[model samples]
Target chain A: MKELDPLLHSQLRLAIVSLLLTVEEADFVWLKEKTEATSGNLSVQLDKLSEAGYISVRKEIVGKKPRTTCSLTPKGRDALNEYVRTLKEYLHI
Target chain B: MKTDELTEKESIELISRMIEKTRNEMNGDDFNSFLAYGYAAVAISIAVWLLTHFTGNDMWCFGWFAMFIPYLLSFFKKGKPEVVTYMDRMMDSVWKVIGSMFGISLLIIVVAGAISGIIDFSMMMPLSIIYAGIGTSITGLIINEKWFVWTPLAGLAAAIWMLTCGWTGGSYDNSWNLLFAASFLIYMVLPAHIVRHKISRS
Candidate 1:
């Protein structure tokens, strides 16, 4: 069984998920810019989230340019909510 | 160990925590400064409008005066970085929408001006400025930023009125230049004071 606490543990992945929660969908460049993470690092983190079935990645052409967009899955949203609830509980806020 | 080595879940959790912490630490000082600058620009513009309306002199002078107050205030009141950063995010989003609309409007004006070569290139500068004021005001309303509703309304109204009067040779009587001036005062200066008070309180 995967631990809920483990899902709440990493910083870069946490940033990516939090940003995706606010925006409907974000492009790779946008997420990279907002999080100030390098391309290689963000790519690795995104793959991990995709593997966990927490996010969906789509590649499409925008203005004749190939773009990759990432959106939070239902599972991602639920996991995020649970993580937030637990954090609040821990902080007693 | 490395900053870049966090797991996916761990990354998500860490960012969530950072945002939460950042929001908790937010104070009203930065918001206050933003409002202050906004209002001061507005108030001064309104005062200029009244002066130009009654005295029948050049309104553009007053308009320029009104626009300068916010720039001055921003220079003086440099607040905390966190609050500033948050406010920047909020305002930048607001401004971006306004900017996009303003760009569209400018395209309209440019096409119109080009077709009617009677309108000089120099005129585009003032027209763009006035349209930007109007765009920002409307954007404010859309975003529920009540502090910004007045300046653009005043500007748009003034612009429409001036354009109409110029075309028909009505009350303004070809004094479209003065009306543009008056619009700036009403739109830019008048709102500045209101924004300033709102910011100071918050």
Candidate 2:
């Protein structure tokens, strides 16, 4: 089995990626709300994932309201799937 | 602790809390707004017909103007602010613009009908209402919202009712109002609520 990066193993980052994977795309606010993380915390984790090239960010306006949206990159998706697969193997579920 | 210094567990907990808070904020406002517009379109259309029948006045021109109110409210007010995300706003805007186009078209048709005298002015009311429904439903389909299908279906039913029942023969009876109410309640009101609920959850 391929090893998962320890940096990607953080619980908050895992939840962020997991939620994004299910929804395909989500806003920073959505991620903050969904994962129940503080705005500052979510931002830091997002920056980490973005630096790893696992996620992409886009900023745009919705009805004169500014918003930041995030989507999982191919690498992020692969890493998430691999992480879940490894966990499943370990749990034998 | 500063967010940057917080452990992973704290971050996860915070995000989970925000999602729950936002979800609770989802009221039936959008759903009700849609229903209000749907009902207004039908009611105003019928009211114009009744007024014309009694006063022998050309009130159909005013019906078109009445229909514009709900459409404007939906576009400018409901769901405009809370949809903080860009994609969500884009999707919402697509529906709004489509609805506006229909309103404009219906206004044009009403004016043309009034001027040309091609059809009885009384028929204009029901026709305008039916057209509004058609426009809403088409917009719904364009946005892939299953709830929107009901508007057109209700419009079709309204059109059929208007055609079969003669205008002078108590066609604007209480039963017709009941039917209008039922169509809006079941088709527009219920489905819109369901869709809004789903969007809130996601």
Candidate 3:
């Protein structure tokens, strides 16, 4: 049996990647609002995905506040596609 | 969502729901932009219609210049790329293309009308309405909005009817302007309200 990609196996990480897939990029606040995740928790998960090369995180100063934006990397997109393809097999849909 | 371990089915469901959420939030200000343009179109068209009616002058036709104001405001009002979704970008591209095509067509009609003398300033009114319909139809297709697709057809039909009837009603000069106003009302204003309602509900 093929196993799910470990990086995307977690719920929050998966949701983050899914959300980022639909948009060009997303800010920390926007992702936090969409996933309804605590700031600290979302930050940690985002870091894990960043380390896994699933997403790129950019930190910059914007209008007197530090802002973080996340975007799906090409590797991350492929992983997502493969993950979905595997899931379809498991679900037999 | 609980960041705990998820089953295959649970993970799939989560992904699906999150994607839906993203789509809903994509065009956050589109409805507002639509409403602004809708009201502007109706207002400017009506004012010009009345002006032409009273003064017997086609110079009021320049009022169409006001239509681009709403579009300019919309461009400035757009959210940053980090916040704008792929769908929003697609919608923006669609409108940009439509606007460009309309502008080119308008220039052609105006210059041609001036040279030929057969196509006057007043004739441009109905033609513009028909072009508006074409734009609406294209927008509808891009957004998968069925009503938008059909709405423009009605405008085109009315414009054609007015043209063929040769201003069947009272003032022939003002008839096209009235048609333009009516199309803006039915297509733009009414759709704007419906979009507002949907946005509110969502």
In terms of lDDT, the best-performing candidate is 3
Per-residue CA lDDT of model 2 for B31-146, tens digit only, reads 56666876674576467556766776664335546656775665666333422432344445766665565656656766887889753344544554465566557646655677
Model 3 residue pairs with clashes: none
Give one digit per residue, the lDDT tens place, for model 3 in B47-145. Answer: 988898899997888887888798777666634545667767776777777678777877887789888885455555566677767777776676677
Compose the digit string of candidate 1's lDDT tens values, residues B1-202: 1234454445445666656644433333233433454455445545555666678664343354344455566556533231223344565676667557556765776788789884333333345446567655754565456646665666566666655654575543324444555554555444555554665676
Which window of ten consecutive residues has the lowest lDDT sum in model 1 chain B?
A: B78-87
Per-residue lDDT, model 1, residue B180, is 56
Every model: Cα RMSD to truth: 9.7, 6.8, 4.3
**lDDT score at residue B132, model 1, on the 0-100 scale:** 60
Best-fitting candidate, measured by TM-score? 3
- Residue B80, candidate 2: alpha-carbon lDDT: 31
Ten consecutive residues with minimal summed lDDT in candidate 3 chain B? B166-175
Per-candidate TM-score, chain A: 0.88, 0.85, 0.97
Clash pairs detected, candidate 2: A33-B19, A35-B15, A35-B16, A36-B14, A36-B15, A36-B16, A36-B17, A37-B14, A37-B15
